[model samples]
Target: MPPSLLLQHAPCARPTAKRTASLFSAAVLASKDGGGARPPRPRPRGKPRFSRQSAIRKSFQQEQVVFSTPVSPDPTVAVIGGGASGLACASALAARGVRSVVFDTGMHGLGGRMATRAVDDERQLVFDHAAQFFTASDERFQKLVEEWVERGLVREWRGSIGELEAGGHFRPIHSSTPRYIGVNGMRPLADAMLPENDLIKVIRPSWISKLEPFNGLWRLFENEKPRGQYDAIVIAHNGKCANRLLSTSGLPQLTKQMKRLELSSVWALLAAFEGPFPIPHNNSYGTFEGAFVRGVDSLSWMANNTRKLFPFETDRPECWTFFSTASYGRRNKVPQENIPNATAEKVQREMLGGVELALGLSKGSLQLPFYTRVQLWGAALPMNTPGVPCIFDPQGRAGICGDWLTGSSIEAAVLSGISLGDHVADYFASCGERPEEFAIGLDDSLNRVEGHDIGQFPGLDSSQKPQVAEAQLTATI
Candidate 1:
């Protein structure tokens, strides 16, 4: 994520309409209409050149990223982290006759940070606590999304978005590209990708603490105990987790590089109001799906989860997730689950204060949510990344893949997984040890993806424009 994720001003475009949305989840993606390509290079007189931090507002800034591995053979593989990257890797490998077992902490269920909170009470209400929607422009990902659309697993979110400025002014945001969300909730999208008794196996509520070697294969340990053995392991997770796991797995060089990829924290609060959604400061749109707020320290994002769902309803109780800025989260981070700097009620009031200010409501106008839950992500917004697509060690027969490989965003996550899986499959095929029914193929689009150990590769020709666009959307809250 960009260091200026929380610092986009009028001079810089935001992610939503180039309205920055790093606070929404661990990774952020910009819409086609949100932040477009740099307008024909040469600036308009006095306008400053958009900084890399500002470049992040653009969703696709394709880097010359490549995933290469010097590996031997693999049949049973272990994929850690059940997020977008991990699941996609497993799915690709499974289709190729490679068997993999996925392990995750599952704090947010099978989707990792892509989660939804199903509020329990007399009335059923759900809040998309993370990753409101994702954009698919790549051919392969577009094909994958098409299948999901056909199965009624996802739907387009066509509602108009707005940006909230420092003065509380709100304006309409128009975009050409469509934003898609899960049919029921984001979690269902991940749940639907699970294969039945084949190459993919899911182990949830599991924290993989370490990895060890026995004989020729790898032994995975959960909570400090040996869990299973596998021919290879994929570290599909954040940089911190990857570094720790690699450090213990006897890969010091890789661990040191991973440790350099830093990330910031965020606090996501899920709440459901009793009345209709809150009106904007100027009541501009009559209703809106979401807003990217600037000049507010307490809150950076606010979304009406119900409104984002297709067939927008005029009358529906508002349910939204508020994401706190890195500064705010760091200030209020609890030492323990029970021990806290402030009482629960006090924290709730402070969060509500940001909402009320954004909506131009008077004191206490925002009602207390009937259902409320707070979650702290120590590694929410990615700060710096390796941007190498994926990493592998043939001698160790292990590798790592995630959004961190190419900064943080949904697109990065998907591409990273696909690239890693391809290398793994190719490694097996080269060793003449892969299954005969292998279906994995590296065609034209993949050749466009090139990666290295250090320094950004310059392939800024017209052909690589889409990839550059894809890499441009990595900002934080």
Candidate 2:
């Protein structure tokens, strides 16, 4: 039998595109035929028949503009995160001939919430504590995911997934969209996205406490020590640390937008069991790889990490991850670095019991895991978004990108980072010249961008909508 998990209540403590243009060809053919009779009309004086437009519209500038520049140009960027967004941004910039230095506080590795933890005990249990799997709805992102799949960084997760209700009713989620996961864990996907050149330098386990502007360049500092100076800065992170770093960076508008971002907390519990769960199943259903738990106060999600990574093997230790609802996290929040043992035990007990209840198992009926741990995601997911692809402050030479700017997913983070990186590269190539098209997420009156379901979550109520005031449109410059 597995070791019993101890429980005790103690004192509180301590985170699509479309195209047109076929009819014109048919009209040209009909004009030249004998049935049309008259000769084709002469072209207008000094006007070519198919002259393409030179000026780009402000709304479509980011997608349409392409500039050529050599790699390792004069301008260097400082990317302040090594997660999906930051690495993707660095990769995109490197492709455009710009150099970038990425700084992250991840001790184990990059990939922020795309995290995985392995218990070093003899069992050697592995768990993807944060993001389980991701799907690509945009064609641009689908192409990138396909590339990762071909390179062995990612593969399709064909395991069973569904919604687990509080009454122990399970409804399998069926969708045509393909779900992808990293070969080992979610972190390797970000590792593979990184470019293989020296133009993009990565510095990990480094916390950037502040940013100081000197000689028209941003100098980063870890506490009092100066890290380096760069021509531009890309803030690929958010939450309290980010707010503190930019509180006095002299970029008032950028700071204001950062402050407006609302983030939520969550609790993830990782448990390693001896065997498969006792839930009954049939030939039509394989082991559950993931689920979005509904109507449960204490838990929101659960994933079978062992099945997800090694579906064919049954001899390995069974690993599972349970995610608490945002509200439950709020009620039991504590500092991640210094979680009291009492608090940890309490959370572990409550979450495990919650899981048992969801599975309709009697209280304490399930076998205890050989190992267990609890983690607090102080700023887990974004509660609101600016509904933009990315944010860039051209004048201050600072930009921001993450899942918050677009949607809460790995794909959103990558796309946001790539967009900001490409725009900054273009700005540098043009020698500090930019049109209004480069200014995004700056106008207070800007309409929310489409395709993102901001402030919408399974457990979020309508009253929880982000309270951002709509203002008159004003020039960012």
What TM-score fits each model? 0.73, 0.78
Q: What is the C-alpha lDDT of each candidate?
A: 0.58, 0.67
Q: Model 1 segments beyond 4 Å from truth?
A: 1-74, 278-283, 310-316, 335-346, 432-477
Model 1 alpha-carbon miss at residue 105, Å: 1.3
Shift of residue 74 alpha carbon in model 2, Å: 0.6
Q: Which regions of candidate 2 deviate over 4 angstroms?
A: 1-73, 280-286, 435-437, 444-477
Per-residue error for 177 in candidate 1, Å, reads: 0.9
What lDDT does candidate 2 reach at residue 295?
A: 65
Reference-based TM-score, model 1: 0.73
Give per-residue CA lDDT, model 2, range 1-477, as digits (tens): 001111111111000000001221222221122212123433236522211312212231121222211212245678999888898888787665555788999999988878888777776688888777777776667778888887888998878877676656676766667777888888777778776655567888899997765444566788866686566789999999998888867666677788887666777889998878877432335456776676677777788899899887788988998888767777898888899999999999999888887776788888999888888888876765777888887666788989778657787887898788778866665555443556778654323322211111222222222333110000000
Best-matching candidate per lDDT: 2
